[model samples]
Target chain A: MHPVSLRKIAKVYHLDAVTVPALAEVSLDIRPGVFTVLSGPSGSGKTTLLNLIGCIDRPDEGEVIVADQAVQSMSDDALSDFRARHIGFVFQTFNLLPVLTAFENIEYPLVLAKMPAAARKKRVLELLDAVGLAERGDSRPGQLSGGQRQRVAIARALATAPKLVLADEPTANLDSQTGAAIIALMRKLQREHDASFVFSSHDPQVRAEADDVIFIRDGRIAGVEQRTAATQERAAS
Target chain B: MNTWLLALRNLLRNRRRSLATLLAMVVGLTAILLFGGYRSNILYGMETGFVQQSGHLQVQRRGYFLDGSDNPSAYGMPRYREIIDAIQRDPVLAPMAVVVTPTLQLGGIAGNYSAGASRSVVASGLVANERNHMLQWNDYDMISYAQPLALEGAAEDAVVVGTGVARKLQLCAALEVANCRQTPAADAPVEAAATGSPAPDDVLALSALEKAQQPRGAYNRIEMLAATASGAPNVASLTVVKASNFGIKAIDDIYLAMHLAQAQKLIYGAGRPEATAVIMQLRHTAQMPEARARLTALLASDFAGEPLEVLDFQTLNPMYRQTDEFMASMFGFIALLIGVIVLFTIGNTMGTAVMERTVEIGTLRAMGVRRGGIRRLFMCEALLLGAIGSVVGLTVALMVSWFINHSGWAWTPPGYSYAYLILVRVWQDVPLLVGSVLGMIAVTVASAWWPASRAAKLQIVDALRHA
Candidate 1:
């Protein structure tokens, strides 16, 4: 079964008395083990779509199925449980908790999962080394550079071994080299974990590297494009 | 990290705000504790004074409480020995009894023959010498009363007059009426004539004339006149012995004391021993209620068909009870005020905390931290604040109490003669301390509830977008 299936979803937001459409009649399916990107201009509902897929939000009208379960109709508490078990998230600003160290940020989800202490430690240590910041495990978010902070956020996202990882403009705050490196690390981790990677971004590098890219405009899906091997090779060079 | 550790780290995020919030809690707690401690001291002092002055329990003919002030002998307990014996036999009352003294309540006219000094006074007659030792040990101000009543030597047949009565009669050092010739020149200061008496402007000169007309030490012969229970006038002449200060101005102005037998002879005629009341002191104030109840039952069984009432100190002195109730109400209002102030102070702290961590909350929510976990985090934070504040505030309170106690400050309450020092017994106040601290913890946690719920209920998209 597909890890995510959205059927004719609609979402409207009211800003004061004015109505705005964030998404309209959007239908999509995300397959397992694929690196996917929702590419759009600002205000085109990429983040909103990612939020709905992550189960952090629900469509105003539609069926949202994640991991063979109907997510849109679930209660808030049930949604929270489903999300904790099935989804991970990374944010534009690398929303690492300021008060927690790098290691703790990675360990947070495992703690919520009620994993045993020894296993939790082993999982966090492996993620920190995979993100190439094993030595910076004790450093708080404030002590890390933007690139390092994003690495910690990525490590945190994969710590729960979720069925899907949802990131919203995860590289927006990093330098080009750091952004490229973060993208490379996320792809490598996605392949190794066999988890579907769905992220919202306008970055061309992200679009070039993605297995599949869905383009959105004016609150609706514009087109779908697959990355050819030649395009991936060109982007890597 | 554990939730509690995370809460601690969050508190450290804003050191100044956290410290300010902590200080607010500490101050509120300290205010409640110190005010409560000071009031406790006031109640303690009043209780001690009341107990020493009137004993813990009193037994009398029902008529004594009802109307014996008018004719004390008419309501006298002629069989007081039997009642005292029964009290000594009761299992509850026997062990608790410290001093059980028989007393005769008397009212009469006091005068000196040679100096022609006269005044009306109310009096108590007791077994003088032993009671004097008892008074010396208990009444804090009794040390100032000149030489207690002794049953022999120069003091035999002598009555102790109150300072007010002594001054009224122009009695000298030995409480003798003024006689310049009989009083050795060295002992007589002539101050009565030199300074004149303290009187109102219109009567000041008249008082001076009266002082001059009397000599020092001549009227050693003192007389007491009263109407017996049968309404016949009776008089007894005795020597003025020692001037006494009972600390109460109203009592001092007219009180007299003498031997119980002498008073019994003067009022009820010789060979008849009668007492209006019997007062009992207990080993501990806590025992008073049980003693009163058990003794009342014992008295009922012993004096079947007789009119007798057993009264506790509180019933006999409504003023003390009224004062206690007033203090309780005032302290209760203060406690509630402090509680409200602390509540708002903590509520504001948690509210600011929720606002400051919006994006972080959104991230956690997206990562699947439940709303209940968020609420629990804030609640733990509130609990930590209260616990830390209460421990620190209790220390501050103890220090302040020690400083006040050792500061050598003393005050004389309205009806007291000597100044007493302010004392704060912090160690003895464990219940109040524990109770206040626990109450503060509960209040602080409760204050965090709405803010915690607000934090937990934030919309992930909106919260993440908050600047």
Candidate 2:
């Protein structure tokens, strides 16, 4: 089954008396265990779609099903549990709690899951090594470089082995070299953890590394293109 | 790491704001504790004073507390000595009774016959050694001691009059009294007697022969006049041994203390000697209720048909209760003021912290922490501040109280004519210390509730976008 599927989902925002339709009747399916990109320019509903798939926001109409469960039907606590177990997210700013170290930030989701300390520590250490931040585990977010913070964020998203990881503008604030490194690290982690990575980006280089690219404009999906086996293999490599 | 550790770290992120909030809490808490201790001392000091003077409980005739001062002999307990003995020997009260004795109250006119001046006075006749023992009751560790009466082995006719009486009698010089002021009218009688001039009726009525018998200003001798039990006038010649200050203006103006035998003779000559009150000083002030209960039971059964009623020191002296209530009200008002200050201080700090951490809160929520967890995190931080402030505040309060106790500062309280130690009592009072701590914590948590709730109810996506 697809990790996430949306059917004619819509979202709106009200600023004072003005109503802005951020997303309208968007339909998509995210293939399991693939690196996908929702490619669009600013205010193009790409991040809105990522938020809907992450179960962080609700749609005004239609259905959003994640891990084969309709997310909109769950209570807030149940939805939180669902998100903690089945989904993870990465922000453009790498929103790690500033007070916690990189290791503690990666262990946060597992702590939410109430994993025992021994198991949480082992899992956090393994994820830190996987993200090339094992030795920098004790460094706070303020002490880490942009590329290093993004690597730590990727490890945190995959810490619970979630079925889907949604990122919004994952490289918008990074230098080109750091951006390319983060993109490569995310792709490698997706392959290693076998979790679907659906991130929103406007960068052509970023979209070029995706197994699937969905283009959207004006709150509606414009197109979806799936790479061939050779192209997917090359992208994965 | 644990949630508390996370909360502590979050607080440490903004050290200045957190310290400001903590300082507000600590200052408020210390002020509250210090005032609370001072209030305790006032009540304790007054309690010790009353117990030392009038014993913890007194057994008096019915209607005595209301009207006996007007004519105390009418309500006199004729067999008070036997009653005191029974109380001292009773199985239940024997251990608690530190001193059980009888006191005689009489109203009379004290006249310096040689000076040709007379003023109305109220006198207490006390067993000198027993009265000295009663003056030594210091149950709350007041660190104060009363000077024993100087009439312990003096003649039965010796007496002590207040400085006010000495001033009115124009005998301040003879008694070696200090701070005594004599009115010009006080010399009118003596001056008239010396010049053979006309004088007021009180001075003119005294026989010239009596005034001539004693030299003017040569001796501290006074004549006491009181109506005997049969309503016949009786007079006694007393040698004034001392003029003491009773620390109350009105009581001092009319105060006299003499040996019991002399007072009984002056009031009930050739008849059964009686006592106005059976003073029972207890080993501890806390034992008053038990001692009173047992004494009342004894009076009802063993000394029936005497119209006797038992009264505790607090009940007998309503001023103590009034002062206590007044102090309590003032303390409550000050405590409320400080509590409000602390409340708003902590609230503002938490409010600012919530605003600064909006995106962090959203991240926590996205990482699967429930709203309750968010609320608890902030509340934990606030409570930690309160707990630390209380402990440190109490420590500071105790230190300050100890310093003041040893500072030798003294000030007269209301209704007192002399100054007393400015003492603050706190260490042995567990209820005050524990209640202050809990009250501070409760205020801290309550203050944080609104901010914590706001943090919890934040829209995740909106918070993530906060700048």
Candidate 3:
């Protein structure tokens, strides 16, 4: 079953008197338990499309159905609740609250969900151990390395056990080795948790780790490639 | 728990800004408390001075105030004893004293004879012991016989004189001969008198004659006869016994006390010895209204067809009101200035904090914290700052006030000659401290509200993007 469905989605920004189209009539369906990468060069509307799917921004004219709820018609507050319940987000900057420790950052989503204290503690500890940062839970974001910080962000994103995770260039700041490790961790968590992971990236390492690839040029989808078929095609060529 | 903990953590994250705001609140609250305390002290002092020195009510002969001649003989209230007795029985009135002293006031010829000449002076007489009591009650010293030299034999009419009177007489020593210049002969013309030797002025003459004729520096010894009751005379004279460097110099120099019986006898004669009005002390001033009303009714009924006036300190003395109003205005002005300073400091500090924490506030909002929660967070911080500041400020103020009270700083009030060390009165100052502290808290919280609300209302998107 599809976890996220978008039909003819569009987003426009009014800069002064100019109307800039960020996304134009885009349509797609994302199923559960699959790793998908949306790949494009700069200004190809990859981030905008991710933002729409993440419910942080709304498409000007479109139907965005997440977990069978029509997100396009939801109020800002309702949409916030929806995002908190179903969509976990990872950003390029590893947006951890500087004042909070790794454990606190991971527990933040659970707090927003108002989970019981015991449950929150249990979930946070589980995620911290899962991210291999159980020993570093008390350390603030500034005390952690870039790879560790990204790992903490991923742990925080999955703490609420969200069904759909949107990662916008999550490994853009990490070294190739750290990047591959983070991607592998995310894929492993997805398979175990039965959650779908969607990454907007131009990085080859990120693209290679995906199960399916959606390529875009300008503001339109250029093509889609399945991993097994693409591998066979590449070998044949 | 998580939101509040996050809020607290965020506050500590920006240490310098938070500290700056806290410091401003503390200083503002402290100043307010101190100023309020000072004002209360001054007001209490003034009120106590008023109540103790001046009774809530006074009874006088109807025309005594207007004529400036309130002699007991001329306007005697025949039932003076009855009135005093009646007032003393009342429960609410705190009457301190009920005195019926005679006053013999006259612009008369006073003289002292020596071998060379006799000098002229102004003489006044009062009921002695009672006069001394009145002076002492108002914190004045008793007079001594050594200060005014007594005359002998034919010149036994020796009198105590004010410094001003002494200067006028030009007496080198007490009871020494100071001659009066004789009046020029009017019929012989001014030219003849200027040419003739000025005749020696008569030392024995009446002040009544001095009034009838315009005499030229002629000294008269008005042998004013004052009768005294058998034993020690009730009159006690008040000379410049020991002139202090402080307090009411005019009364010190000019006042004279004589026996009440003597004054009544000399001024009113033997058959009619009476007092103009009676003074009474009650239990307390709070009972003054009922006491006054009861007294007035009694006087009206008992002394039918007679005119009497019941006057209070507020009515008899105009200066008291002026002093009270001036002190009140001074206290008010000081309080206002302090309050303004506190308000501005807190406002500025909170404004800076709100500006710096835009992003943190946005994050909280995005995390499902409501606008009201943000405002509450800021208010709590303000309250904490105010509470801490008030305590510190009160401690400092108490210490300073203590130092001042014990500093041995002395001052002589205007119209006074003696100096007294300054003292801080705690009973009068505690309320001031409380009021000021509360005022500081109020102003600090009020000043912080607008800025905190502004921070709470910041757009989440823009704030999240803020660098």
lDDT, residue B161, model 2: 85
TM-score (C-alpha, index-matched) for candidate 2: 0.91
lDDT of 1 at A230: 83
| Candidate 3 lDDT by residue in tens digits, B131-214 | 333322321111111222121111222344544333333332332423423223322322244333332233123322433343
Clashes of 3: 26
Candidate 3 residues lying further than 4 Å off, grouped into runs, are A1-11, A14-19, A23-39, A44-89, A108-119, A162-167, A191-200, A209-237, B1-11, B14-30, B55-355, B410-428
Identify the candidate with maximal DockQ.
Answer: 1
Going through the candidates in order, their DockQ values are 0.77, 0.73, 0.19
Task: State the local distance difference test value for candidate 2.
Answer: 0.86
lDDT of candidate 1 at residue A34, scale 0 to 100:
92
- Please tell me which predicted candidate would have the highest TM-score against the true structure: 2
Residue B283 local lDDT, model 3? 39
Supply the TM-score for candidate 1.
0.87
In the predicted model 1, the residue pairs found to clash are B178-B215, B178-B216, B179-B215, B179-B216, B179-B217
Docking class of 3: incorrect
What TM-score does structure 3 among the candidates reach? 0.66
Tens digit per residue, CA lDDT, model 2, B1-467: 77899989988999999888888888888888888888988888778878998998999999998987657678999989889888978999999888888989999888774566778999999999999888888888885536677788998888988878888776787788887765444444555544223444543344343456655654687778788888876777788888887777677789889999999998989899999999988988878888888889999999887899999999889999999999989989998999999999999999999999999998888878888889999999898888888888888888998998899999986666678878888787778899888999999999999999999999888888899
Whose lDDT is greatest here? 2
